[model samples]
Target: MEEYFSAVRKMEQTVMFPSLLQGVSLGDLANTLDSSSNEKDLYESYTLLKSIKTMVEDGLVPLNQTFPVATQMKEQEIKEEEDLESLFYYHVSSLYRILTRLTRRAKAVTSKYDEIMGQMNQNEKRLSF
Candidate 1:
């Protein structure tokens, strides 16, 4: 049961979550007038998501590092009242969840990388023994 749960979490972090994150184009979301509201929401959501990804990749801090605040400020504006800040407050709970998942993924990836390296080193030692 424990092994099964670990495998499921690994799959969630590495395979499923990344697939959801990839191939998003903010530019296309920015364009398109008629559907601006929906697109804008998507853009904001993805922008926050990508920023979190960048922080993880850049190693600014380790996984599970607490973000400074809920919402990051961008130059462009969305709706007057329904801007990113407002949306973030409204969705603060979900944001926490997303951040937690991302942090888990970041840590999992690092752990997997370290494990592979350790295995390689062990094999090298065995071969040289």
Candidate 2:
């Protein structure tokens, strides 16, 4: 999980996110144009991934009523065996699942960004030559 998160963060820092986004504008990443283009969705997920992690790190869960992830997680956890250890395991498993999904999503967004960057590079090379 950390591996995936680290990999995605590295990619985002190095290439996935550029100041100019090459030829892709901020608008391109903000709104869905068509089904063939998913830049908007990817960027949304990218921001969401970061936002969720930051919220967790900042102690926004359990007390912060505005955190949707916490609310959703609470609703999803199994409501069986109201013992301390059982509840502990349930929370642990739920957190593990959420982290895994978020990290994998970050990696997928990175992959899509890499593909976009590659295409931009190819276009640049063609124009330069």
- Each model's lDDT: 0.45, 0.61
lDDT agreement of model 1 with the native: 0.45
Tens-digit lDDT track for model 1 on 10-127?
A: 4434432343333443343232222323333322443444465555457656436645552233222244455668767756777565555544433444344345457768999999
TM-score of each: 0.36, 0.64
Instruction: Give one digit per residue, the lDDT tens place, for model 2 in 30-56.
Output: 332223433445556666667766666
Best by TM-score: 2
Q: List the residue pairs that clash in candidate 2.
A: none
Cα displacement (Å) at residue 66, model 1: 26
Q: How many angstroms is residue 90 displaced in model 2 relative to the true structure, after the best TM-score fit?
A: 0.9
List ranges where model 1 is wrong by over 4 Å.
Answer: 1-52, 55-88
